[model samples]
Target chain A: MRPYLYIAKVRMLSALAYRFDVLSSIVIQCLAVIASCFFWIAAYGNQQAALGVTRDQMLTYTVMSSTLACLLTMNVENRIAASVQKGSVALDLLKPVNIFGIYLWEDIGSVAIAFLQNAVPLLLIGALFIVAPVPASAAHFLLFILSAAFSYMINWLIAALFGMWSFRIVRIFPLLCMKGHMIRLLSGSVIPLWFFPQWLQTVLSFLPFRYIYQLPLSVYIGILSPRETAAQMGIQFIWILLLGCLFFEIKKGVTRHLLVQGG
Target chain B: MPLIKVNDLVKEYTVIKKGKGLKGALKSLLHKEKEILRAVNHISFSIQHGEIVGYIGPNGAGKSTTVKMLSGILSPTSGEILIDGLSPQKDRKRVVQNLGVVFGQRSQLNWDLRLGESFELLKRIYRIDDRQYQENLAMMDAILEIHKFIHTPVRQLSLGQRMRGDLAAAMLHSPQVLFLDEPTIGLDVDGKQAIRKFVKEINRLKQTTVILTTHDLGDIQELCSRLIIISEGTIVEDGSLSDLIDRIAPYRILHVELYEEAELPIHPLAEKIRQDGTAAVYRFDKKKVTAAQLIEDLSCFCKMKDFRLEEARIEDIIRAAYHKKEKLEGV
Candidate 1:
């Protein structure tokens, strides 16, 4: 456990050392936030009661979801797939720690860094320039944090599953890109699912993406009642458990093949 | 028991064979022809404790594959390996805890961390105690002078410096077995010598068993007492350098620098291998005739300005073996 923690600590330090990349990411996020703010404000022009929320709430939702997006989406899958292709994953296998554990810890480290460098500043800027809604109460804020953590874990597990496919296939970037586009469209990050057609909204209720992007944002903005918030959190937990089990199964198969094929 | 034992070790890979041009590519995608490559054939060897054994071979000779399997990074298709009575396939964590591996072509350290920071991270990863960590660091700094560039990030360090840092990082846990795959590749004379010296010192002081794989003959001559030569996924020769030279090429060369141009001597015991304007080379089987007898016979044919005897080097012997194998394979 300590060794795994050390892996995370080193990753965080590495993230700090590469300040240029951090700065670039912050800049990109700032541009994205400003662009979306204008796009949403213009689209909502003079419509006070669009999607059952005021213009102010819609602006808050856009900014809030964008900030949450910074925390949830990670590049763990790309990095893992690259390592597999380059054969450097062999060195990781030689380590005493478990491969899945190492990646999980590294994801945690990146999340901590992303929250500090990308999320906090974007949220602050939104609060000043846009009418971002504050948390309804302390309890709602606490529940939102729990939901966000679950969302992070679920996202990592999904990425891990896709990454494990690289061991057997040569190219997975196409599938990964499609996954990103689908999540953005269905999870209400691009546009709130409330604005989608009735059939589409019902379809998204069956998928887990909404739990990651929409649930946490809606919870923070007090869009859901207490019972609804608890139900959504429960659904998020179910996704984590399902994704985790699947990840472990794939990980076992991949590691076994790695040993047999001498990757 | 031997510290490391391998019996009938084998590794096979299923590789997709791709064709050239658009037609071939389309055909390959439709048919998907696959071939099984036997990277490591059945090989058997055992090493006692504290032995610095040199594992040498040409490219694509299963050297890296064997090392990877032994270090638990890869599993054998069929065979048995016991590292201190533990099977890496069955007890990967325990076996890896006792083993340290370094590949010269790739680094295990994080490029963003300074040298000292990388060491510290490894220390925590390996769970080395404070006393052991400090003592090992001090000893490593003495041997490799790591303290000089300990603050520099790995990406900023030169190749030589990175190799030194890598060697130290691998030894952070004081592993009993160290597997170095081409540790001195692309290094200068000084860097190679420093690495050779470090391997010797660690082997001597801690009795750490070393399995070194390299292309440099100088490293083999200076560091290894025994050699294992592998070609085409199998061990061709395994013994001391002298024994290998004696068995594979039991001959000596007699170079005679002549005062003037002259015809080389034709003798039943010696062959005139090469000749220049004022120099001649005669190769003779030492078993058939002595150096003195060859020189005496050569003198009868020409006036010799100077003469010297040269024994077969490891490079020559290994090259002969490689060519012989190539002929047998008809490749």
Candidate 2:
């Protein structure tokens, strides 16, 4: 655990050297959300309180979703895939610490960066357009925070599971890119879960993807009442436990095939 | 106690072979031939503490594979490796805590970060205290001249400069054993010589055990007292430098330059193998004759203007060993 923090801090500081890349990414992602926010604001302007969602409420949902996206993303899969490909995985494995733990901390490190670069700015922008919804009360906000923590674990586990393919496949980037794009689309960042048809929304509720992006954001936006939010938090906690086991199993399976080349 | 020990180490790899052409590539998706390559086979060697041994071999000779196993990078298919009395594959973290490694082709330094920043990061990763860290930085900066580019990013440094810094970084925390795989490769003559001098100095000053694998013969000739040449996954020669040369190749090339064309050397001491106008080459065996005797015999037959003796170098002997293996296999 001590070394984990050390690696995470080092990696974060190293990443800070590339401020231009970080700044560019923030600008581009902000533009993307702003473009979608305006389009949906226009769509809600024509509706006369349809679906119990006003223009402000719809914009709030978009803002909340984007913030959650920022907190949840940090290139965890890319790091694993890269280490696997370049054979640098050997160096990490040879370290006197758990490789999975170091990577998870590194994942969290990137999310901390996104929290600064992505979540705060987008939320500020959303506040300018509409009144952003906080949790129902302090309890609801605390629950949402806990749910967000579990979401990090679940998301990392999924990425680790998929990243294991890098050991066997040559062109893993295309597959990883497709996976990331799909997760973004289905988790309600590009398209809000509220806008989806009732049946599609019900089907999506069964999948854990919503807990990471959609459910946590919805809890922030007061879409789920107190009772409903508690139930969703229970589901997220269960997913976290299950995903923890899966991440360990995938780690054991993948490292068995680790071929460390000398020089 | 032995700092490193191995028992019948073997590493086998499964590689898929895709046939040529797009059609074959498509077919490879459905079914492909899997060939097993034995990189290291039943190799067993151990090193006492503070011993610097040179591991040399031709291309595809499994030298690096053995090093990776001892360093805890790769696991053996079937064998046991104990570094400092701990199984490297089983107690990997502990093994690595006491070991350090440097690969010539792959750098451990962060490319975009400054040299001092990289050292700072490693200090934390290796858990070196501030006091020791400061001492190490000062010593390393003086030894490798790291202060020149300590503020410059790694990507901006010359290859030679980066290599010097890398050596210092690997030695930080004063790891008890160091595995250097081709550490002096691709450097100029002066750069190579500099690394050799530093390596010798460290081994003598610190008593740090060093296992070096390299294609460069100079590395073995200069630093190593004992050399091991492994070919086709087996050590063919393991002895002092002079002993290996004596065992493998017992021949020398003697060249003579005369004022006129003359090929008359059929004596017991020397034999003319080849002849060109005004020049002749002789093969002399020490067991059969001496260089002085061969020169004297050749001088009597032909009026010699210039003469020089050539013994089979380390590189030539290793090459001959490999070529001999290839010839026996008819490959």
Candidate 3:
């Protein structure tokens, strides 16, 4: 346990080494937050009733979505794929530690960095200038944090699933991009699922993507009461349990035939 | 007991056979043809404690494959590997506790972190206590002179510096058995000498058993007391370097330069192989005639200005072994 925490610490230091890169990404995410705010406000178009969610609530959803996007989707797939291509992952195996465990700890480091560097800033700016923030209560904020933690786990499991495919596939860029776009579209980050057509909403319900970003944002905007939030948390836990099992199974199979390619 | 043991180890990989061009690629996509590559095949050897044995082979002769299996990086398809009385496949964690591995082409250190920071991370990962970690770092720094660049990031370090850093990292845990795959590869003469000194000191002081795989003959000559040569996934030669040379090429060449041009002398134990101007070269079996005796017989018949004896070169013997010469095969 201490060793894994040290790995997380090292990863955080590694991320901090590229301070310029993190700062630049923050700038881009901030721009995205502003653009999303304008787009949603324009869509509301002075209408008091938009899908029964006020313009203020929609704007709040936009702010939470931006934060959730940065917090959850870290693109750990690209880093894993590159390491596979370099054959450096073999070194990771030499240690007594589990390979996936290291990746999880590393992702936690990255998520923490991303949250502190990007998400927190966006939430502060959005709450200050972009929109007047209102949480249903202090308990809702606490529940949102719990839901967001679950969302991060779901996002990591999904990214790891894609990352493991690089062991077999030569080109993982297209697959990675597809995952990004699919997550953005289905997670209601691009547009809240409340406005989606009935059939599309039905299809999105089957996926765990929305639970990662959309549900957490919904909880933040007070769209769900305490009872609904509690029930959604239960559903999120189920997804976490199922995906965790699947991820470990796939990882076991992958490592059994572990082939370190390239040099 | 041998510190490391292997019996008929084998590793096979199935690779897809891809064709060239558009039509061939399309056809291959429809019907996949797979080929099995026997990376390591039925090789066996054992090493006692405190021995630096060189594992040498030509390219793709399964040197790395064997090391990978022994180090628990790759599993063998069939065979048994016992490192210090434990099977690497079945008792990997226990075996790994007593093993250290280094690969020349790649490093285990984190690239973005400082050298000391990387070591600290490894210290935690390996669970080295504070006192032990500090002692190991001091020992490594003394030998590697790593203190000068310990604060530098791994990516920023020169190749030699990084290699030293890698070597130091591998030794922090002080495993009983060390597997080095080209540890001195791509280093300058001084860098190579530093590594050689480190390996020697570690083995001498700690009784560490080292299995080194390298193409560098200098490393073999200066460090290893034993050599294991493999080719085509089989052990072609395994013994002391001198014994290998003696078995493969038993004769030594004697060159003599006379004061003046004279008729080549005939002696019972030597055969004149070359004669040019006033110089003559003879190939003689050392078992039949000693160098001193042959020179004494030659000086009795003629005046000799200069003379020298040359044994078989190691490079030639290894090349001959690789080619599977009829007499040298299975020797």
Most accurate candidate by lDDT: 3
Instruction: Please state the Cα-based DockQ of model 3 relative to the true two-chain complex.
Output: 0.68
Clashing pairs in 2: none
Write model 3 residue lDDT over A1-263, tens digit each, in one string.
99899988888898888878988998898888889899877887879668778888888888888877887856568767887777777787788777778888888887888888888888888988799566667877888889999998888888998999987775788999999998988888878887899999898888898898888888888888778888878888999999999987887677657677743
Instruction: Count steric clashes of candidate 3.
Output: 0
Better of 1 and 3 by lDDT: 3
Q: Candidate 3: lDDT over CA atoms?
A: 0.85
True contacts kept of 3: 0.62
Instruction: Score candidate 1 by TM-score against the native.
Output: 0.92
Model 2 stretches with alpha carbons more than 4 Å out = A46-50, A129-135, A260-263, B253-283, B287-306, B324-331
Residue A260 in model 1: lDDT: 27
Candidate 3, which segments miss by more than 4 Å at Cα? B326-331
lDDT of 3 at B267: 80
lDDT on C-alpha atoms for all candidate structures: 0.85, 0.78, 0.85
Interface RMSD of each: 2.3, 1.9, 1.4
| Candidate that would win on DockQ | 3
DockQ ranking from best to worst?
3, 1, 2
Model 1: lDDT to the true structure = 0.85
B55 Cα displacement, candidate 3 (Å): 0.8
